[model samples]
Structure formats: structure tokens, C-alpha cells
Target: MTCTTAVLLPGTGSDEVFVRAAFAGPLREAGIALTAPAPPPDGTALIEGYLAAFEATAAGVDGKLLVGGVSLGAHLAVEWALRHPERCSGLLLALPAWNGVPDGAPASVAARISADMVERDGLADALRIATDGVAPWLAAELNRAWPRHAAGLAAGLRAAGAHPAPTLDALAQLRVPVGIAACTDDPVHPVAVANAWAAALPRAHVRETTLAALGEDRAALGRAAIEAWQQASASQGSD
Candidate 1:
């Protein structure tokens, strides 16, 4: 199947703006149109919003859609693909936080902690703590995104923190080609998780980049994911 459109979702507490910046250029160069929807206002509806957006977008498309996203968004994309494999052409997952139950994964823990901070200290203080030790680019990104969430931010974080990604066993059942991108230096979203996902999926490839590179160029992560997807798709054709 030739997929010309990709519908991507944002990570926990993120919005479509960042998603566009991260993926639009690379996907455009690859001849794929990008659809990045604004997250729902209610944080608790994050997953539902993403799934609904995918369904709505896929409805107007001619063929199967390419689907994926970053962090929690990637998890939701996989979940949607598993449920509707016939409508999905492939995956372009970036920075998958964990497989199966979060089990105190760094990303999960961080989300939970941030949620608590937002509730206890309010958004301003929470944002300060959240961005305190992050890279400048990351901090800037968060500073811009976190404010948008505002009152709903804690709910969104808590929802994401509690949600479970597809397990490795479940992943093995997904036959669609998958391209996973991982940041070598991202402790929150460890590279090992991406490697494990690639190992489990029948038609999958993993590409590595660094957070430093990502900071220097927003498109770095998207380029890695697109390249990995191309490799996976080619391998599928050969098979």
C-alpha cells in the first residue's frame, strides 16, 4: 500500500504546534502530507481525542494511513493500529516511552511527578520544576507547550502516566512495517525501549539520533523516523 498521509499525535502535555515542527518538513520531503490535530481541552480525553482524530482523518483518505507519534502519542498510535490494522499502512514511532505497563518508567514517573507538582504548586511552579534541568531547547519547548495545558495539564499527565502501551507480546502480532526513532541520550525515553520494539515487530527498524542533535535541529528526529520507516518498508517489499 502506498501511504501518502500520516496522522500524528503529540506527546503528553504537548500540542500540534510542536508535532508540526518536528515532523512536517521531513514528512513533506518524503511526499507525505501531515495531519497533526490540536489536543482536546480535557486532559482525561487525550487518548480518546487522538483516536477520534485518526478515525476522522482516515475516513477521508483513499487508502490505509501511516500513523505514529512521540512518547504517549506513539503508544496511542500503536494501540489504534492494533485495533484497526486494515486502516493502517505503517508506523513512524518516535521516542516510545515504555512497553506494556509503565512500571515506574522514567517517563511515567516524571509525568506523575509533574502532575503532582502542578496540583500542589500550580502550573507556574510546576513548569519551573519541569524545565529546571532540561536542555535549553527542550525547556523552551516545554515552556511553550505546558502553558497551553494550564488547568488540564495535571489531568493529562496523570492520564498518560497511568496508561499502558502495547506489550511486546502484543507488538509481535502487528504485521505492519514500523519505523522507530530513539534518542541515544534521552533517559526518560530510553533507547532500549525502541530496540525492544523493533525486535518484537516482524517488519520494523530502529534508528538512533541524539537529543543534542534533536536540540540543534527539530527535524533530526523526524528524519531518523522517516529513514527507519523507509528501511522497514523496503524490507517488507523484499520479503
Candidate 2:
């Protein structure tokens, strides 16, 4: 049986391949249609760009539309949901970053590095730093696609640092339910941010799981995320 359509947005410097691994199989198995945009190169315009992409996608699909993302993707999802709560059915947020730029946020450093990359080495240097110690396959892929990846991260970092503090007062008005999944081992997307989102969104249900629980395997993350999505969606149906 087909379920509602859901859009999955990748994090900073991430491509469709990475996000597809994380969500496509699971979402497809769950009978959810998936839509994802290529990451924009300009860090500053990232969220607005994503919002526009989502708007275009939402226009094409019928019925309830669930929006989700990882890291910067999650941030953009939340921002969009805030603006058009009625248009969204629910949210599947994974690895959300800071509520806003906190002191010593890595985004600050990333932004600086991003500015430098556009001029000389391009994304080569930043891509090395962004994916250096990540999963080997992921790192290798980023190494090959460094320029495009770098530009997206540069734009995301600019967006992250400049994004205003998210207020729940607007989110509090949302009738759409939310599911937030956090990776305990993630340094970039902290658990605190997930907890904050849970507290802020009146209908948000949060699950804090370890990377090990989700496994290094992408399928594992997708499975765990689906479980959370089920619980959140079920609750919404009940309400």
C-alpha cells in the first residue's frame, strides 16, 4: 500500500547518493514517495533554496506531504515547516544541528574555510576536512565529488551561522506531528538539539539512539528512522 509522500534532504556537503542510502530504500519499502534536490553550492542561500525546491515538489504531489532531512537538511525542513505548517503533514528529522549558532559552533570555522575555498583550491581543501574521518566509502565518494560537495557545505555553513534562533512560539502553533531521530555519536548534530526540538514542538516525539544501534550500515539507520516515523505518525492519526 502506498503511504504519503515524503521529501528527504541531505546534510551539508551531502549528495543524493548519501541521502538515498539513508532514506530511499526504507521510505520506498514503507511505500512513501521520495523527492530530494541536489545540494546548492552557495552556503548562505541553502535553506531558502531548499524551501523553494520543496515548494515546487509539494505542488506536484497530492495528499499529505511529510518532509524530512539530516543535519542542514533537518534545519531546512524545520524552517519550511514553520512557515507553511498547513502544507506539511509531518516531519522526520534526523541529526538536527544547533538551535542557532552557539558559541564555538563548528559552522563558524566551516564558513571561514568555505570563503577561502571559492577563491583558490575550490572545494578540494574543505572536502578533505569535511569528510576526512567519516566512513571510508563516504570519504572516498566525497573525495571524488569534492568541488560540488564543498560548495554545498560552504553554503550550508553560511546558512547555519546566519540562521536566526528558531522559535517554538510559531512551531507551537503547528498541528502537524513531528518525529525526531538523533545519533548519539554524531559530533556535528548534537543530542541537545534533538531534546530542545522535542521540548519545543508540542506534538514532537523524539528518539535518541546510538550510531551503533542504527549501525554503520545505512539500512540500519533507515529502519530505526522508520520505526520512529511509525510511532509519530500513528500518534498523529490518533490525535
Candidate 3:
């Protein structure tokens, strides 16, 4: 399928600003227009809001869409695609946190912890606690995005922490090509999870990068996912 447009979403407490920075250039170079929607402020409705946005965006397009995103965003994209397979061309999943249920996964645990902190200590204090001991680039990203979430930050984190990603069995049903990206050095989003996703998906490839590379250039993650997608697409075409 020819996909000229991509609708990418952001991770927990993240906004379209980060999504655009990560994917806009790479997608532009690939001649694909990108729509990075701003997530709704109400955390309770995040999943539904994201799905609605995807549907609305796809409605305006002529052909199937390249749908995906980072972390929780990636999970939600898969959920949407599973429901509307014909509308999806492929996936560009980055930093998949876990398979099946959250099940106290590292990412889920951290999200829950962060949510608790945000609720008890407020955004500024929670951010300090969350960013502490993290890489400067990551800290900077949280500082930039977290405040925008403000009052809804805790709810959003809790909602994401509780949400389950597509299970391995469900992934097997998705015949579309997928490109998964994993950060080799990032513990929050384990590479093992990405590998599991690749193993379950019918036509999927994984490209590994490091958090340091992503820190130096936001496009590093996007490039990894796109490269993996390209490989999957080539393999699918060959078959």
C-alpha cells in the first residue's frame, strides 16, 4: 500500500512539539506529510481522544495511513490499527514498553510512580524527582513537556500506566508491515520488549539505537524506525 501521510502521537506527558521534532524531518525527507495532534488534556479520555483524532485524520486522507508513535503512543496506535486495519498502511513503533498487560512493567511502574509524585508533590516537585539522575536531554524533554500537562499530568500518567498494549496473539493478526525502534541503553523502554513485538508481528523489523544518539539528535529514533519499516516493506514486497 502507498502511504503518503503519517499520523504520529506523543508519549506520556509529552506533546506534539516533541513528536514533530522527532518525526517531521524524517517523514518530510521521505515525502510523507505528518500530522502530530496535540493530545487532549483530560487524561481519562486520552485513549478515546487519540482514537478519535486518528479516525478524523484518516477520514481526510485518500489512502491508508502510516500510523505509530513513541512508547504509550505506539501502544495506542496499534490498538487503533487493530480496530481499523484497512485504514492502516503500516506501523512505525518506537520504544514499545511492554506486551499484553502492563503487569508492573518497568515503564508502567515508573509511570505510576511519576503519577503518584505529581499528585502528591505537584508538577514542579514531581518533575524534579522524575528528572533527577536522568540524562540532561531527557530531563530537558520532561521539563519542556511536563508543565504543559500540569493539572492533568498525574491522571495521564496513571491512565497510561494502567493501559495494556496489544498482546502477542493480537499482533500476529496484523499482517501489515511494521518498523520497530528500540533504545539499547534505555531501561524504561526495554529493547527486549521491542524484540518480542518483532517476533510476534507477521512482517516486522527492528532497528536498535542508543539513548545517547537520540539525545544528540531527536531524529535518531525516527531514522531507526523508518529504516526498520523500510526493511519490512522491502521484505513484504519481495514476498
Candidate 4:
């Protein structure tokens, strides 16, 4: 089935602008309208709130829609699609951060620690630590975006840290087209997780790229993955 519309969700601490930067143009080129909503104001109940918003948004769409997102967003999208299997035409899940649970996942670990630190020490000290200790670009990005939404960021992190991914059985039931993308060298969104997802999902195709390339062109990651999935579908159809 062709995807007419795709509702893309941003990961923890990410805003609507980041989601648009990640997908809008490429999805539009594929004739899909991208609907990316802003994160809810309440951070404490973020995952539940965001998923509810995603479901509401998907329900409002005229046709069967593609649902997916980055990190926490991607994990919940799988759950979303399965819950309303009839509404999902496809999935554009980027950056599968962890497997079944949040335990031992780097992203989760970071989220929990960050959330605890932010809660206890305040956003200023937390920001200072992150901006000083983390990578140059990330520190810059966080500095620019995190101050205003410190509470929201901490809440999203705490929520994500506790969330779990869809079980293997749930993934196996997803027969629609799936485009999974991840960065090979990035520790947060690992290639192994993408490989596991590609193996579990019946119709998933994966594309491996680098963090540098993604930093340079965010749209390229989605473009490559969707194109690969489309090519695989075409090949299978001809066969």
C-alpha cells in the first residue's frame, strides 16, 4: 500500500522544527504529506501524552497513514501501528535506540542520568555539564534549544528512560512497508538495533549511514531508507 500521509514524531527534547528538518522535504518528494506536531506542554506525562497526540493525529487523517519517529517516537510508532493496524499503511521509523526495554540502552541511560541531574541540580548546572562535556555540535544544539524547554526536556528524558519498545511478536505482525534507518557509528542509535528491527519486521528495509552524513543532510537518511524499501518492494513485486 502506498503511504499518502506520514505523521513523524520527534524524539525526546526534539521540537517540531527538528522533525521537519529530519523528514518534511523527502517525504513530500515521495508524495507524502508530513504532519509533525509540537510536543505537549506537560513533560511529566510525555510518552503517554505524545502517543495520545499521535493517535489523535493519525485518526484525523483522511486515509491510512504512515506513522513513525526518531528514538522514543519510533518505538511508540510501532506500538501505535499495531494498536490500530487498519490505520497504518507504512512506517518510517528512524533510529531504533533500544530493544524491548529501556534497561542497558545508552539512550535510556543518558536520559535517566540527565533527568536525575536536571531535576536535582537544576537545568543550569546540567546544561553546563552537557555543553562542556559533550560533543561540540551537540553542546551547541542543546545550548540553543534546551534552556527554554528545560522542564520539557527533563520530562521527556525521564519518560523515555522508562519506556519500552514493541515486543518481537508485535513487530512480526507488522506486514506493511517499513523503512528503518540508523547511523552505523553512532552509539546512541546503533546499527545492531536497526539490524534487529530489520530482522523482526516482515517488510522492513534498513539503510546504514554515518552521524556526520546525517548532521550534514538530515533528509538524506529518510530519503535513502524509503527509496531502499521502495526498491525492495518493486523487486519483490516483479519477482
Positional deviation of residue 55's Cα in model 1 after best superposition, in angstroms: 1.0
Superposed on all Cα atoms, model 2 deviates from the true structure by an RMSD in Å of 3.0
In model 3, the worst 10-residue window by lDDT is 230-239
Rank all candidate structures by their lDDT, best first, as comma-separated numbers. Answer: 1, 3, 4, 2
Tens digits of per-residue lDDT for model 3, 1-239: 47899999999889899888888998888888999999788888888888888999999999899999999999999999999998899999999999989998999999999999988998889889889899999999999998887677888888898999999999999988999999999999999999999999999999999999989999999989988998999987722
Query: lDDT tens string, model 1, 82-185?
Result: 99999999999999999999998999999999999999998888889888988999999989999898677899999999999999999998888898999999
lDDT by candidate, in order shown:
0.91, 0.69, 0.91, 0.79
Model 4 lDDT at residue 215: 67
For candidate 4, lDDT tens digit of each residue in 5-93? 88878877666676787788888787888888777777878877878977788767776887888888889889898889888877888
Clash totals in order? 0, 3, 0, 0
Clashes of 3: 0
Q: What lDDT is reached at residue 19 by model 2?
A: 75
Model 4 clash tally, residue pairs: 0
Clashing pairs for predicted structure model 4, backbone only: none
Task: Give me the displacement of residue 161 in model 1, in angstroms.
Answer: 0.5
**Model 2: per-residue Cα lDDT over 1-239, one tens digit each:** 13468887876556666777778888888888778788766666777777788898888887657887877777778788777776787778887766655455554455456556644555656566667667776676566544565535555655655665455565566666777888778776678877887787877777777766544666555555666767766775722
**Least well predicted 10-residue stretch by lDDT in candidate 2:** 102-111
